[model samples]
Target: MKMDGETEQLHVVLFPFMAHGHMIPTLDMARLFAARGVKTTLITTPLNAPTFTTAIQKGKNTSRPPLINIQVFRFPAQEAGLPQGCENLEQALGPGVMDQFFKASAMLKEQLEQFLDKTRPDCLMAGMIFTWATDSASKFNIPRLVFHGTCYFSLCVGEILRLHQPYKNVSSDQEPVNTFLLPSLPHQIHMTRLQLSEELWSNKETDYKKRSSKVKESELESFGVIVNSFYELEPDYADFFKKDLGRRAWHIGPVSLYNRSNQEKAQRGKTSSIDQHECLKWLNSKKPDSVIYICFGSTIHLIPSQIHQVLMALEATGQEFIWVVRNEDDLGGFEQKMTGKGLIIRGWAPQMLILEHEAIGAFVTHCGWNSTLEGIAAGLPMVTWPMFAEQFYNEKLVTDILKIGIPVGAKKWTTVPSIEDVIKQNAIEKALREIMEGDAAEERRCRSKEFKNMAWKALEEGGSSYSDLSALIHELRGLSTKNHN
Candidate 1:
């Protein structure tokens, strides 16, 4: 843990799931360890290493960027289910494969063993899909931690709830609509019937429990967990994870916040994504807390109608705002028509900065874990429009339970998708206006202020988040020492 004591840098190996969602956050975490003068090697499939390294290189525009000196190492993956040139874990999980998850993990374990034998690292940090990573850490006699991409509150609850058999399968009379308020927290969480209505053997059910839980159990039985969150914002939930769950958990986020202060990262050559300066220029012109930032997390698919309606609603509201429409096809002529009131960025965004901006008012988010946490850190009220996955659960927390935000347009629980589902621009306009004005707006803003204070406190010098991170490093160091002895 002492930077001064090292002869060189301590070597740490990182392996993230192949999905972009997992890749970005885990890459962010690896960047943190690397930023601290630690020598880090990001271990992944050969096919992915080049692309990831390119992204990292792009993110670290060299000249004054606080560079994450991470080396990328690729281990060969068996090409059975994987597509050509797609040697990543995701490639392994492709069609015509059964138990591909475990098989891929087993192959990775062998690859890691060979790599570690040649290039020893002090610790191993992995994605939730790398079910054998903890074991690999143990085999190598190194410290281990799993990188989680969700809000710990959401992750903890989702993992536990997944254990229960489907309540939707039971007779309506015999079943109770499932709702439980979190203990020691100020929110209630429930499962909607739509969520319950998915097929019993669907791929959704398989991914959530079979693969995700397997990864979770592997991590739990290992060293600890490293989360991208600070403790103050979700104190009760963080406490539960550490104390009741009996896991060593560290919260060192908003990771993107540190990136803001990291002048070195700003100049990075490659990924310096989207035109940030231009984006901010547009944002600068908007009223404080007046703009609605709408974006679904990457990888979500939405109908064209859904996007068109949301666009018109923003247009009808005539509110000055920044809209991050990743897919431009749905907007039609809305961007050109509502020229003065809107700004749309084509691709990736400096999301944390936008949320933290003085002029921004609300977030129209896809309810992904990363966006949700970032939004909370910035103290912005939300307009929940869950696309799919665990997002529905997160939407429940944000709207139904937290009271800090509400759903967009229609009521979630009972509303059936009508023919007018996509064209209800007035409904979108009304929802936007309500959350941005009157008593409701003031109350939500006050709540945001309360959370902001808590977030600052969590990241302060000896705060829970800092201490947890320090502890994880210390524990890993101890493991290294014992190995030497």
Candidate 2:
């Protein structure tokens, strides 16, 4: 399908899950398409559109104005039994509203299909949760590509574990301390059953499993999977996803680094609600690689007890720290308790900017995929305190595979209450020390640096990730050409 020396227009629609972690990376992917002269449209709800404004403005500021359109649709909040504006996962903070959020999300299907019919996009690229988009794309004879915001390592491990259920044989009582070895990995990977999410270990039926099954089915029916990972960073795992899954897959990321707004400006207007300058100034006062930056990505809700324990641990370390306080109630005047010791951002913080700062010695993270990739890009070792979802799997990658982190010894999943293992101040202190100043910290730091180099190289021209992006764009253009003829 030659273009006769003329560039044929290819329009791609990006429909990401409402979570910020999902939105940010998918937006970056859209920017990549725009950078290559592909027309892109990001379909989002009215409430979520504002979040993309700063990044969109940043794209326009650059010489080549990204042909990225912002298509906002009305959310069915009332129908879903949610408040008028509660369209996103972050806004629905309580567990009760999760079903409502999904209900609203499902309602978008009709509008999205109508939008697709009107616009006739060359392809639809959507988050894993939007499983219905595959069928929508099929109606138009268009390809629907599933975008997974995590790395190839976590994805492979998750798929393998799901199929084999190796942990199934491990007794429930023994899971608290016992380790289960995964059978068919290039490297030996072992984890306690407790390390997995509670739902995975449950014997009864769950809505989670039902939802996950749909996502899995959607992936099997989709054109391919677009993952936010780099080839050099996980060569073996990347190969595993491509070969074993028998699916077209592209490892074209750490996509956050590609957008200037995300990497350089802290995304200005669209970033944290708190002040960025104050935090950066405080970071300037600290020594190189001496500050620990702590943040849990948007979805994780920490109990007050856990928050207190984290505060005590940070204070005990006596190290300079920066913490993102999501819930004001959780702080309980801890800011005054540690006045000169650390800085606290009241709301969201510019995570990428903070991670990239030279003063960041270690990260205390929830092990979210976005945070994990950002930490790797920054070359900082971590203190992994996984809360929920694929975070525990990501923790395994960081602690076992990458060898760039120390676990905070959270024995049970935070989302469910099968058994609560309070991560004590002493355990937190020890994990912080191991990542910051322990004997193996140097090795971890060196490994982090190596990954950082590879991450950058993967994005460079002629690199693996770079080639994957190019191939994807070419394939999409060919699809459009074929559809037209």
Candidate 3:
């Protein structure tokens, strides 16, 4: 791709799904691309753009001029019968209105195609949920890569379970009663039917199943997958995804590490409810490795009963902690009771900053990939309490393979969790003690520290992730050259 006797720069377009979890990493990935001198454009909705503004501006000032661009398309919230500002999944997928969010997402396809036609980018990296993107990229002969927003372990586990149907042999969905091993993986991963989604086990074809099938098909048809993991993080599963599955894939993360500064870390995803300095000051007041940081990510809000149980557990353990909650209405002045002992962030917390703090020793997490990786990067052992989605799969990676986490014994899976899904105070306290107390806790911390070192090395100049990013950019340039000729 030579222009005026010099090689033309590659232009890459990133289209992330409108969820905080999905968009955050994709935004980091955009910065990674731009840092490598690739012209990058991030396609997002108007409302979603604000979440990314700070990070994007930081990239522009840090990097060469015009390295990144923002392309916006109007979200059809009204047509989808959603609230006017309901552009993101956090707002749109409420209760029975999930279909409306999907409908609105589908409406953006035509606009995206128009942008593709105008920009004619060399590569398109889109979120996995946007199945129609494969065809859109094909129309313009651009290379399309799917970003699944998870580790290779989960994907391998998911694909094998989907293909093998080993759960069928079980007579019941009970946890230990009908536990099964995922066959032919790098490790002997155990699972129960209760941990998996109903769509995976059920024979009935539902809307969710149909959508998943389309997404899987699109993944296979795309150029490759861009994973938010590094090779050292999950070597066996990474090998399995590429060699065994024969899928084209690249691992170029701990993407959260892209934010090298404290300011960037504080402003990574959304505005923090508590001031960054205030959070740091409180953490500094605690002794080293004394505070447990608890958060369930943006999507999963605990029910009142579940919240009460967690509070009871935290209180009973007498552990100093920082808990990020969706609402404080359920608290009923519990914050006052634990004034010096606890900090309850009402909305978003500066997770990356909090994780890296020296005073923080353990994490009580929902096992979301983003939080999981952040915890691993910070060398903090976790109390894994998986609620839904691929969180259970990630919990297995943490507890079984890594041996750096203690599961809180969450059994059921549901989007709208009920009383049955609530883990009692006793269970929560037990797991917390397991990760924060004995000689076993020290061993987990040692292992977690080793991973933290590996994560750092993976992003260095000649390291796995750095090399992978360079290789991807080189490949995209090759494609551009081929097309130009």
lDDT of each: 0.65, 0.83, 0.90
Runs of candidate 2 with Cα error greater than 4 angstroms are 1-8, 175-178, 261-264, 268-270, 416-419
In model 1, the Cα lDDT at residue 415 comes to 20
Off by over 4 Å in 3: 1-8, 60-66
Report the lDDT tens digits of candidate 1 across residue range 1-485.
Answer: 34465723567787777666666666666666666556677766555565456656655664324334444444333443443455443334323443554455456666777777777788778877677778777776777778767666776665545555444343432225443333333344545444432432244665435665677678778777778877766676777777766677788776654454433233222233566676677777777787777777555545677777777777677777777655445677777887878777665566666777888888877687778877877888888776445676677667765578867743232123445444377767877897788998889978976776676666666877667756766667676766776
TM-score (all chains, Cα) for each model: 0.83, 0.95, 0.97
What does candidate 2 score on TM?
0.95
Candidate 3 per-residue C-alpha lDDT over 1-485 given as tens digits, one digit per residue, 9 for 90 to 100: 55422323789999999999999999889888877778889999999998777777765565344477889899999998998899989886576678889888989999999999998999999999899999999999999999999999999998998789899989876546689889999899888988888877888988888888899999999999999988988999999999999999999999899888788898888888889999999999999999999999898878899889989999999999999998644787798999999999999999999999999999999999999999999999999989888999999999999999999988877777888888999999999888899999999999999999999999999999999998898888888989978
Which scores greater on lDDT, model 1 or model 2? 2
Model 1 regions lying over 4 Å from their true place: 1-4, 7-9, 45-78, 85-107, 163-170, 173-188, 196-208, 261-273, 400-402, 409-427
Error of 3 at 209 (Å): 0.7
Clashes of each: 9, 0, 0
Model 1: lDDT equals 0.65
